[model samples]
Every structure is written in structure tokens, then in C-alpha cells.
Target: MINLALLIFLVVLFTQIVSWVGKTVLQEVAFAVYSRVFLSGTASKQRQLRKQVLAEKAELGWTSSQDEFAKWAKLRRKLDKGIADLEKINTTLTSSKTSFSVKFNSLLWILMTGSQLFLVWWYRKQPIFWLPQGWVPKPVAWILSFPSAPLGSVSSGAWGAVCKRVLQSVEEIVKAILEPTVVPNGPFPTAPFPAQSQSQPSAKIEPITLEHEKLD
Candidate 1:
């Protein structure tokens, strides 16, 4: 009979490894597909535009860049809407809450991990994969040495990814809400009024008329 505790440990370790590998592979694949289809020649241009917009905003100050910012903000909202539309289409196609790509990747990860755990179970009843001591590659040896530790770190990485996505979403939402507020008020026509000085008013001069009647 296989030791239950050992089986559990191997299962968890393999799951972590599979999750890491799957995420890495899936990201590369997804980026390739997304860039080829949607971004194509525009990825570099978009990056340049973002840098230019940020530079203009920083140099001119926020109040002055209202029109430029509004243009950028409108583009941003359109991009977000496109992403939401893609997600909606994916959800409908997969009949799942998230995208079909995500679900498929997840399912593949589970199968890969389960197969590995089954191999470990078939070969040994021990809770851990013990490494033979001599002349192994340093990197492989290092990984094998701390399987349990890496599993904990894998969970940490997952949590960090989730937190980063949440923060990005919140940032986008805040930007959307505040974008209109930054618009410069339209310039108004004004009559040019002469500036008043602070000096005392000049005294009025009165002509003397008393001498002329007596002389006549």
C-alpha cells in the first residue's frame, strides 16, 4: 500500500511544477497569437505613443495637456472595450465564466501534473523524490533539494499575479472615471479693461478771473 502522506506530498509538488510550466508556456503562446492577430505592426507604435503621451503630460503639466489626455483616454477606453468584447466572445464559445483559452490551459496543466504524480506513485511509496548524490547538474540538484519549499513559493507567485491584475484593473477604472475631469475648460472671450493705478487723483486746475473786472 502507498503511504498516504507521501502521495499527498508528491501530488502537491508535481502540481506546482505543472502550474509553473503551464503558465510560462501559455504566456509565450498567448503573446505570439495576440501580437500576430491583433497587434501586428502596431505594438511598437502603441508603445511609442504611450511614451510620447506621458512625456507631453509631464512636460506641460496636467492642466495644460487636457486635449491630448482626452485623446489618449478615449483610445484607452476603446482598447478596454475591445478586450471586454473579446472576453465576452470567449466566454460564450467556451460556455465558461472565463476565456476558453484559460480553461483549456488549466485542464492541460491538471492532466500533465496528474500523470507525473501517477508515475511517482507507481515507482515509489516514499513521500519525496530522493536524489542520488554524485555529479548532477547544479540547477537540477538545487530544485530537487527543495521541492517542498518551491511549492510554497509557487503559491506565493500565484497570489502575486492575482494582486497585480487586481491593481491594474483598479487603476484602469480610476483612470476612466477621472479622464473627463481633466479636460481644459473652453477659452472665453474677455474685454480688455485698462488697469487702474493706485496713485492719488490729480487736483483740478481753476483759472483765476478776479483781476479783469476791477481793471476795466
Candidate 2:
């Protein structure tokens, strides 16, 4: 009988431990995926755009030939296209990340509630060790024997509420990160005026002797 009781105790303990571990792992994975894929990608794309803009500005200063202007225009168009693509991708990823976090949190809550109930049931089956000297009802003794189960249930509920809040916070953060800031287009500086000619042409001189010889 003692061995049987110990076996039951071990089973309940193991189940609770596994359930907790599973919840922790699920939360970690959710966070990792959001940070690594969604957040990082958005940041990286923005940084690349910024770098390209800087490089274009640098080229404009040194550019002399028309070919250089054409090359710069091509690069600028490519960068603009890239930025647009990244914006679309970021929107999609943000939606996906939010959905995944909500589902994961819901699963955690379900697992926690079920495990608590199972633990309570398991604990009630075990025999009570201590009882009041006076007459104590069987039902009362069963309830008193496993105080942890009720506490566990309450704890699980509170935890689920907290997890839901956390998931909401994460969603907000992902949305903020993914949303690209609208940078207003600045006016491009006008090109420098071409250099003017420095030297003036000398006036034409006519010979006077040719008219005097013709008259003689």
C-alpha cells in the first residue's frame, strides 16, 4: 500500500514538472522566432536602405560623366524597389507572428488547466495521513488532504491571464518594429552651373593703304 501511494505521488509530481517545462519551452520558442525572423529582418532591410542612400549621396559628389549619372539612377531605382518589397514582407511577417503568439499562449493555458485538474484528481485518490480527533466527514477529509490542488488551479488561472497579457504586449512590439517610418522626401540640390568663357576675341582690323592705291 505504501509503495502504491509513493508511485501515485511520483506520477503526479512528474506530470506537473513536465507541464511546466512545456509551457516554458513554448514561450521561448515563440519569442525566438519573432526576434530572429520578423524583427531582425525588418531592421536589416532598413539598414541596407540607409547605407544605399549614403553611398548614392557620396557618388553624386564625385560623378562627372553621364555614364556615372546613369549608373547612380539605376542603383537608386533598385534600392527603392528593395525597400518596397521589404515593406510588404514585413507586413506579412508581423501578421504571422501575432497569430503564432496567440495560438501558443492559448495552448499553454489549456495545458496548464488540464494538468492542474489531473493533479487534483490524483491527489484526492491518495489516503489522508492526519485527521482531527473528533468525527470528521470523509468528504471533508478528502478536500483537506490536498490543499495544493485548489491553490494550483488558482495559480494556473492567474498564470494564464498573465500569459495572455504578455502575448498581447509581444504583438504590439512586433507591430511597432515592423512598421516602417515614413521618411519625407527631401528636395534634391540643383546641379552646379557650367563654367563661363574667360577670354574675349580681338576686334577685326581693316587695311587703309589698299583704298589709296586704287584711287591713284
Candidate 3:
């Protein structure tokens, strides 16, 4: 039989990665080739527009003579018109991409989350692993066991939760390590210390008076 613990970990890890992919890698499946006919040639239309723009640029560059101002101006106008068309395509692509992502990613998330839930239900009575005897209190062990699993056994529910938490922790640590830190433009300023001086007292004239009295 396949190891339940390994399966649970892999599934949880995969779901998390899928969630990240839709968010970070590509916002819309339609714009990327990773999607197979999902967008129904909408992406192809965008490609065609891009090719048209390139063709316009090349044709104008090679054939259109600059010797005649009128001809050059006419070609320039055509190029500008093609560019405007390209911009329209871009605007449409952006809005449609956002629309597609909202629907696709929402559905994707539901499916992925549901798969985990299904696994829990299907193996509700099964244990991913067995905990050492007396390792944890009865209440805690029961919670980990979950559903109908026997005591001192870790059920799918607990294992899935642990896997998710571990993945989140790892992701957080990675982001912390890879994220750029803002440093000050210069070193911190230090305050100067106050100056202190000690003065010595001068010798008194009592010695002169004693010597004078002795001499007198």
C-alpha cells in the first residue's frame, strides 16, 4: 500500500504550489501557452495582432522611401494606425485576462481544496501514522486521531493540517530570506561626548610667611 503520510504531504504541497502558481506565475491561463485551447484561440488572436504590428514596422522600414516627404508621411500614418490597433488589442487582452483569471482561479481553488477534503473523508478512519504510546495527552491524541481513528494514531485530518502549516512556515521563511531589505543611505549618526577638565589648586603663601618669621 502507498504510504499515507507521503501521499498527504505530497497532495498538500501540490495544492499550495498550485495556489501560488495562479497568483505569482500567471494571472490568466489564456495568456500563457501552458493553457491548451482553454482560451479558444483568443491568445492566437493576440499573437496575430503582434505579428501584424511587426509586419507593418518591417514593410514601412524597407519599402517606403523617405526621399518623398508625402510618401514617408503616408507610411508613418499607416504605422501609427497599426500601433493604435495594437494598443486596443492590449487593452482588451488585459481586461479579458483579468476576467478569465477571476473565473479560472476561483474554480481551481475550489477543486484543489475539495480534493483535500475528499481525501480526509475517504480516509477518515485511517491513520497516516502512529504516535508513540503516552507521547501526548489523551485529549491531544484524540484530536490528532480525529474522526473514527484509534487513539495514538495520526489521522488524515491532523496530518493535512500539519503539512499545510509546515508549508506556510517554509514559504514565510523563504520570503523573509529572499526579500530585499531597505538599508539607510548612510551610517547612523553618533553624538559627541562632553569634554571635562580638572584644575589643580595653587600652593598657599603660608610657607613664605613661616620662612619670613623664621628669618626675622
Candidate 4:
């Protein structure tokens, strides 16, 4: 009975660790990878777009910390539209990159979860001949087990929702940390300029005289 409880406690602890890292580290790593692959060849444009959004937020006396959810939504819409345009231009590259990232991240999490389970299984066997019996104290295990119950209950997809909520708080802290002491003078540059489409602009040429004439 005691061994059973200890084993369960250890499993819960390891699961919580995996969930925490998934929320914090893996989320950011995924974002960085996605941005690098999707935004390739458009680093300058992306920077300009981000600056433009920041400038708008500043003009409106808003940051991610502010109560203006509408402002954030507007910014997101603009950014999404820009991303859509880029994706259209590089459809194959974007699709391949996204597929690879999803598979890679899934494999990483599987390996991490598998190793944690293996460690707990190994510890349960008590391979050592003689040592201090208990590693995880009973009282400490009980305390950890309390939260671990709810954590274990949460579904896999639920973590993404939880992470999004957690990131809201984190985003505010990041905004405060990044707040500039010295503000820039001018407004940020606008969205990446639109590319020329099907229609072509008409051109005019000036006639030249026998001696010399200017061309327009």
C-alpha cells in the first residue's frame, strides 16, 4: 500500500514537471520555429509590421496590459492578414514547414513523457542493496498529490487553453519589462507595402528632336 502511494506520487510529480515545461519552454520554442520558417525572407517586413502595431498601441495609450481587448483584436487581425498573404506567396514552403514542426514537437513530447514514466518505474524497484529507505517523504508527497490530481485530470488539448490563459498574465509582465524609458520620435513604419498585381501602369515617353530633347 505504501509503495503504491509513493509510486503514484512520483508519477504525479513528473507529470506536473512535463506540463509546466510544455506550457513555458515548448510553447515558446514552437513559436520561434514557426516564425523562423513562415517569416523567412520577410524579416524586415515583419519587423516593420510589428513596429507599426506597437506604434498604434502607443498612440492609443494601450499595451497588451491595457483593458482594450478590441485594440489587440484589431492588431491580431492585421497580422493574420499579413501572414495569409505571405502564406499564399509561399504555400508549399509554409505547408511543409508546418507539417515538420508539428511532427517534431509531438515526437519530443512523447519521448519526454516516456522517459519520465521509465524513471518512475525504475525507482519503484529499489535496485540498491542498502540505503536510506524513502526518498520522497510521505507528507511532501501528500501535498504534491493534491494539485497533481487536478493536473492529471486535465485533457491534453486543455493544456493549450490553460497556457493561453497563463500567457495573458505573462504577456503583461513582458510588456512592462520591455516598456522603453526613452520613446522614439517618429511613428512606426506602415505594413509591408502591397505588391503589384495583374494590372500594369501605363508609361509615357517624350519624343526626341533631331538635335536633343528631354525624355519623360
lDDT tens digits by residue: candidate 3, 1-216: 778788888889988887666564655434475334465466677687788778878877876475677876777788898788778877876786777777767866665787788889999998888999999999999999998788899999999999999999999999999999998898788887654433455556664444444564
Residue 14 lDDT in candidate 2? 47
Q: What RMSD, rounded to one decimal, does every model reach?
A: 25.3, 31.0, 6.5, 31.6
Write down the RMSD of candidate 2 (Cα, Å).
Answer: 31.0
In TM-score terms, which candidate is top? 3
Candidate 2, which segments miss by more than 4 Å at Cα? 1-26, 31-69, 118-142, 145-216
Best of the candidates, lDDT: 3
The sequence of per-residue lDDT tens digits that candidate 4 reaches over residues 14-110 is 4555565664476557767766886665655655655665666565455463577787777667766766655554565556557766776676565
Please say which candidate is ahead in TM-score: 1 or 4: 4
- State in Å the error of residue 187, model 3: 3.6
> Ranking by TM-score, best first?
3, 2, 4, 1
Candidate 1: pairs in clash: none
C-alpha lDDT of candidate 1 relative to the true structure: 0.51
Q: Rate the local accuracy (lDDT) of all candidates.
A: 0.51, 0.57, 0.79, 0.53
Question: How close is every model to the real structure, measured as TM-score?
Answer: 0.23, 0.36, 0.59, 0.28
Tell me how far the alpha carbon of residue 114 in candidate 1 is from the true structure, in angstroms, after superposition. 10
- For residues 123-166, write the lDDT of model 2, one tens digit per residue: 54343234444455655543444444332122222333334455
Indicate the residue-level lDDT of 144 in model 1: 40
Give lDDT: candidate 1, residue 89.
Answer: 49
